[model samples]
Target: MTLLTKLKKSNINRSEYLFLENKLAFLTTEVVENKYRNSKLVIGLLGFVSIGLVLVVLWMQRKRKGLPIVGLSRQERNIQGLILQGKSNKEIANELFISISTVKTHITNIYSKLHVSGREELLQKLQN
Candidate 1:
């Protein structure tokens, strides 16, 4: 017999060859499954990133509009500006040369229009 034929016969074993075939099949299947799972993970990460970007865009749009950003009349705007300077009712009255009671009324009106509870909250609302 030829050297190549003799070598092939010496190397061949039916049971060992079948076992190796089964092992290779299992390895191939595992590689394919891992690739599929990796692709799914990549898709999932991209989905989350897209959703996060959309939310950020919406939030930025809202921020650009400012806090509530509703239009204000001249008087309300002036009162709100004065209140932001830590002005008490009497202090605002002295500054505006109005009655203390009128200043209190203006403060109440400002709180109502701003939908806030107190002066500190009002100032915070204006700032951010």
Candidate 2:
């Protein structure tokens, strides 16, 4: 009762039937390939959008907290906090188990990032 069955029962030539069968196979393959490609594209887009949303939420949270220093490294922030608590370079180095020179270097970087020349100015900047 199908079209192919009716065609086979009719006076269709052998070559014509073969051609129609091959064309149908090719169209089916093309449709499956298109669907596969579209699914991959949709999945990739969703991943990209999810990452963007997470980054936006993190930025908003940081902004809401009113952070004073924006670009300080973790180590630098730790040094800044120690400095705020009136810890000297040698004491900070002893507590953190780092060399005094390394502690000094982190302090220098912190000062540069905060645009403060020394600890006093850094404290003043953070307080206000």
Candidate 3:
């Protein structure tokens, strides 16, 4: 039988079917739109996180590169330079306007960092 004849036999009117069909279409469209919006939001968040992670990695790499290039602080490096210039610890202390004990501490720290035992070893290491 034709669809309208079947509908009539089932006691469902054409207007009712049309109304239900329109409602279903509107609901389906709303569901599809919501899914698209949700997916777009997820993708945007992922993109934002990815960019943030990349920037963080780059910043860490830059900081790491700057650190190992000179493991000594400004004062320690200056102390080493003065020592290399053949200045005695007392002379270095006098020139740098620090105490002799502080000069000794800087020397100890330099030796530990450079893996040297004394001024001779430090000079040898510097030459190499």
Candidate 4:
């Protein structure tokens, strides 16, 4: 047994034993200045959990909306991509083998879904 263990086993007064317990705690914690190691681990764990929770929330939100906006459908996204490349609607229609009227209809739908007034607004929305 250790010396401290032996002292504890002795019939010392209860008050002295209590004082010794306090001294040991202080020595191993406050005096040594190493108690923060456990606290740091706890803080790091909490940070990781917080980040994970935030990512999960973001993922669920994204899943709830297949696309961020109603206008950003597959066809609209493709058409917009071509438009941003400076392709005219007719050229886009020819490239996609869609009719000119089909292209115009898609354009109108895209504008309505995007809540845009015209091509300028579409460009602005894409820029941001």
Name the candidate that leads on TM-score: 3
RMSD (Å) of each candidate, 1 decimal:
10.0, 8.3, 8.9, 8.3
Top lDDT model = 2
Q: What are the runs in model 2 whose C-alpha is more than 4 Å off?
A: 1-6, 67-127
| Model 4 pairs in collision | none
Write one digit per residue (lDDT tens) for candidate 3, span 1-128.
85544655676677997776677779989999999999999999999999999999999987764332357889999999999999999999999999999999999998877767799988887876
Error of 3 at 3 (Å): 15
* Candidates, ranked, lDDT: 2, 3, 4, 1
Q: Estimate the TM-score of every prediction.
A: 0.44, 0.47, 0.49, 0.45
lDDT of 1 by residue, 5-99 (tens): 45447776877666766777799899999999999999999999999999999999877654543656666677677877777777778887888
Give the lowest summed-lDDT range of ten residues in model 3. Answer: 62-71
Model 3 segments beyond 4 Å from truth?
A: 1-10, 69-128
Per-residue lDDT tens digits for candidate 4, residues 1-128, read: 96578868999998998898888877877745665877788999999999999999999987755433653678878887887888998999999999989888888888777667788877887787
Q: Can you write out model 2's per-residue Cα lDDT over 9-101, one digit (the tens) per residue?
A: 889899999888788789989999999999999999999999999999999987755545598898988999999999999999999999999
Whole-model lDDT per candidate: 0.76, 0.89, 0.85, 0.81
lDDT of 4: 0.81
Worst 10 residues of 4 by lDDT: 64-73
In candidate 4 the C-alpha lDDT for residue 42 amounts to 90
